[model samples]
Target: MTQISAGERDRADTLASRRDKFILPDGVIYLDGNSLGPVSHTAISRINHAVTHEWAAGLVRSWNSAGWMDLPITLGNRLAPLIGAPADTVIVTDTLTILIAKLLANALALRPDRHVIVTDSDNFHSDFYIADGVAAATRRDITVRRTTRAALAEALDDDVAVVLLTHVDYRTGELLDMADMSALVHAHGALMIWDLAHSTGAVPLHVHEHGADFAAGCGYKYLNGGPGAPAFAYVAPQWLDSLTNFLPGWLGHARPFDFEPTFEKAPGIRALVTSSPSVVGLSALAGALDVFEGISLDVLRRKSLALTDFFITEVEERLPGVFELVTPREHHRRASQVSWRHDEAYGIVQALIARGVIGDFRAPNIARFGFTPLYLSFRDVDVAVSHLVEVMHHREYDDPAFRQKNPVT
Candidate 1:
């Protein structure tokens, strides 16, 4: 492989200066942003202020004074530009699974005549679980199709009500064409609901431009919010009034504080919110988003491609036949991460983590590495590859300690 010096690569990166904004640890090269992003210094400060001043001192009055009630809308507006959705159409609320369940229910309601919900076989497992649970409860049919972009198109038919898919595959980091898929679904008179769990904040998205009917994603991943951070949901303006929310909590009421006997849905996307917003988590996510204030999504995409390209090149040259590249080679068909298939994928991931190079292991035989342009440097990628070489040469992955699986991984 043709080696590119870190200095040369860093000099070309417009996002290099943005690294200081995050609170990453020393002596570690983190390649797991797709799993959970490291917290930013701004997020830490925001949490402190929310807890110490807003919650502790302001008491209940803070609900109005601190704009706590509007946190969901406020953060949604901030996140709109990143996902290419319009104002008032997006809201930060609930976990990804909850939002997915709600969106699927609403989508099915929209197409009551259609009985089938089509999804990829390799899409996130939680998404499949949510769909299966909803189908079982509502007596709907679900078709699990292949993961290829072409296979998805073939699986669509008049019977399909909703085509649910992860924008980027979690294990392989394969990016599906949103615009094309949405158009196909619409042509079949079916709505498209994209799970942006592995795509948002890591890649440039156009939810509205791509004609997505509904979308959902987590804040804890590339958004850099704390663990179990509140997730986001999006509904197109046209469906805001037509779609029905399954879990219509009080906050989603048109007049939530009115204590009315009837449940009146709020106007626009606000009606999708099920319960009270997590003020602390929203505050932290707001701070995390501040880092993207002046940054361009175009620049982020370019840097992400460069980082992954460099890592793939290095791995191929250093460890010839040791691993198989699973992520797509084309930039447009790839997300902000890369993956490899090997028999000892789990042990290899453990060995790398032990060496202070963090990546993740998927079931059976896949090792994944994520690249965040905002905080990662080109040098970090080079060092991570070097550590992998050391681990392989030393046969450290064969150690008995690495064979033991952890609860989380």
Candidate 2:
């Protein structure tokens, strides 16, 4: 009996119909959704409505009439279900870096008696930089620790105020068990703060169920809110009144319209909104999220695993020993993406892009491919592998043009 092709697998996929919602480029197989997701038709229409009707016609009155002032909260409430957060616990505002700094500060403030902030050594670089800056400014020690998933529990201790980690490894697409880690941090009397930058929209996350104290993630990647889309932050209900907002701004003020002399924080997650949110960006995000309204995350997660598994199998069977798989092999420990280590990973990624298969290259030697289930199918994975095979066979990656590194990659 002949084996079913990847294209056939995609044809039978229940989520395959979702690809119609996106506006992917013709002849391009986009595998970099973990970095930046392509814009959708809904987002485009929402932006147009916001611009032509809300902004141009309604003017300042649109802030009230079109619900511009409430976009952040509205979007947050809509996005809450995706992250397993309760209503009003998540606020869509600010960039990922700023949110991380604020969350770290609040975690430390909550545990003032504690002096150490523990984090993974392979955590996203910006997260580490922010941790370093916050630790320096607050006169606290930052402990960067690296451990395998099995040994993560050993890294926590009594002195730790908070344990910050990315739910998924950005480079290797490794998934960390949120519930287990959060439990470990709590056992050590440390608050658990998760950076969901890579996990949000790509995998199933039950932030509240896991008992995470705080969490933050970007909207541009799997959320498909376009570039510089506002990020979301989650503060557990238990810590709402206790955690201080050290970076408080006017919007977060309890009575901003009253123009009070003293700063007073608003209730719940609203208190985390330090500044006015970008209305247009929020509109785009709202539109992007509309695509997920009735979709089940379980189905999405299953398709994601299938997509990555197929890609891994194709690569290993067709191009043996050419690249080393850096991502975890276990289904539960893997995110929606796959990464490989190759000496000319940069050039190989460039060559893939040249063939209209848009994967990306990380620093040094990591080649990353992000499989966004919303718009990606097994057929796309099959085509991507075919191009990769050609690139490897013809030594296309060795081209001098691909060898020159771009500033962005």
Candidate 3:
């Protein structure tokens, strides 16, 4: 059913030569990098060394000798460049939920006189939930405003203490104008906190350049830091001097080991820490980041746009009536993914996976493909399109098993 030619196949085959760097399953077309990136060769080797040699052999000594104690800060410094943040502004720490709580709680502390915490309607659910909890904990009134950019711009008033938003929309892959939004928040005497879960690695970020007061993102998504990987939080350098964390555990204390009776928080980013770093996970993530050693995010962004655009074009031309594109077509307004809306989206996703094209399905009607340029190739994209065409034309997604809802989806 696919009209792809042998020349195109050969070109994709050549492009796949670099795929050896990833530990992907044979015959699988992994289009879920935006969810969880496949492990890299370097990550495996480094994790193995850390588990067998560094931790197993060195034990407690590894904290000081193997530099385990500083992995969070070190990894933060490494990730700073990728996210356009400066050193000491970012700290690799707990899950995104915790990080968001810390950032919001700290931001609220900065503006006790102001009562409102404004956020978009489409923010990731966890962010909204965390903000709700922070409001309850602080006994402060929270106002969530669901509005478009123009709406938000108009709604920005002096009463808003902090403006929260995700840089990229999870479902639609829509990118928000962080710089403009942050400027508007500051102009209204409010701080801005961003959720970067979908933006950090999918595209280039400039927190400092955008004048963001605080930000947080998941480690397992675009960062390719693996499942349950430690997330990161960024506090602007200027706020670092006054930022106060409510979750001040012993690990965050300035003299944690001094057997102090009271909690005296560590200075700067260290104050955000509430627990010891996850050593094994941090080690793996640290190793995985090395893959981007010579890679520029600009190049990554270019390739990402190309891959998503190619997918969109191929889908539109090859299966026009069968699939409906949900992601924005405009390049500047989109992220690194292309999503399609179909009544049988889940079933079609199952069929594609059965045939070895592995994308993901969102709720209701969205089938999502995350095109990670570091491991994806043009040929793989072609092959995926070929499989998709077959599944669509043959009506293979009509299978009952494909329709059954799974717990994970």
Candidate 4:
């Protein structure tokens, strides 16, 4: 790996101009966008307006006047293009966990005869947990089976009802082939569910185009909504009239205000709404998404690849054999982030953060750095790697303070 010309690359980056839209902290090279995207100026403005004007003045009237009641679908439509999904198929609703539960259950409902759900060991923990929980809830002898990505095809069988896989490996930043996987699952006659938590805004996706039966992802990562930002779920329009909403709320009722004794499903994307939309969070997310309105995923992907490639190059040159590069080197098989494996990855992450380079540590031994093309510049990547070089070379992380574990980490 060899470093690219940072000065030249930054001048040529088309997305570099968009960095002004975000309100990143001064003096911090935020490489943790894969975990939690920082707030943008538009997001802040939207949040302020929602707090001061919408909620404070309109009160309950905001549901109708401010379009709060429709945010779940509206925001969903806003995010659809990022994933190459059709407008009516996506809905920003609930947390990723809740959405995962709903999506997996919905797929299971469509395959009652199948007794097994297939997922890889590398899938997000929440996804596996939800799959296991849904299997347990079935009470009809259903089981959740886990395996490696390489064996996903072998894991699938006539008994497999649904297959859930993360588009990007959360810890290793490995990108999976959505089209290939979806086709394989379909060949086996099982519905495919994609957990897009790590790839939603970080990579170019064709969720609906790739024939994914269902999908879910977070809003706080590369999408840049604030912490605790709402998550989204996607249901193929083909199942609009048939998919079951396991956690139905009044909003999902066909005639929400009808208040009928029996539950009636709403039409289209509204069918996925489980409860009232988070007005403030949606407001923030809508504002945050403003920066992405006219952006091209192709352009974004190119910038991401360059940044990661450069970072990996600089690391290999400066740090030598200090850490093992765990993220895939193949551009087609990598996400917008990079990770290195080290025994003291946690301490290394802490040391970098103390120096104002904010990356994150995944469990076990992974130090992760996310590169967001929308706001991150080549200079940012260069500076972050420079700090990492210093931290490792100086043995600054040898201090006991850097080794202490936080509850969150």
Q: Highest TM-score: which candidate?
A: 4
**Model 1 worst lDDT window (10 residues):** 140-149
- Judging by TM-score, tell me the better candidate of 3 and 4: 4
Alpha-carbon runs more than 4 Å astray in model 2: 139-151
* TM-score for each model: 0.97, 0.97, 0.95, 0.98
* Backbone clashes in model 1, listed as residue pairs: none
Off by over 4 Å in 4: 1-4
- 343 in model 2: Cα distance from truth in Å? 0.4
RMSD of each: 1.5, 1.6, 2.3, 1.1
Instruction: Give one digit per residue, the lDDT tens place, for model 4 in 1-409.
Output: 3535788899999888899998888899889999999889999999999999999999989889989988988899999999888988889978999999888888888998998899999888888888889888865788999999999989989999999999999999999999999999999999999999999888998988898999999999999998989999888889887877888889999898888888888988788788988889989899999999888899999999999988988898888899999999999999999999999999999999999998899999999999999988888887888888889888888989999998866
TM-score of 1: 0.97
lDDT value, candidate 1, whole model: 0.90
Candidate 4, poorest ten consecutive residues by summed lDDT: 1-10
lDDT of 1 at 390: 92
Model 3 misplacement above 4 A: 1-18
- Model 3, 302-321: lDDT tens per residue? 87887787788888888878
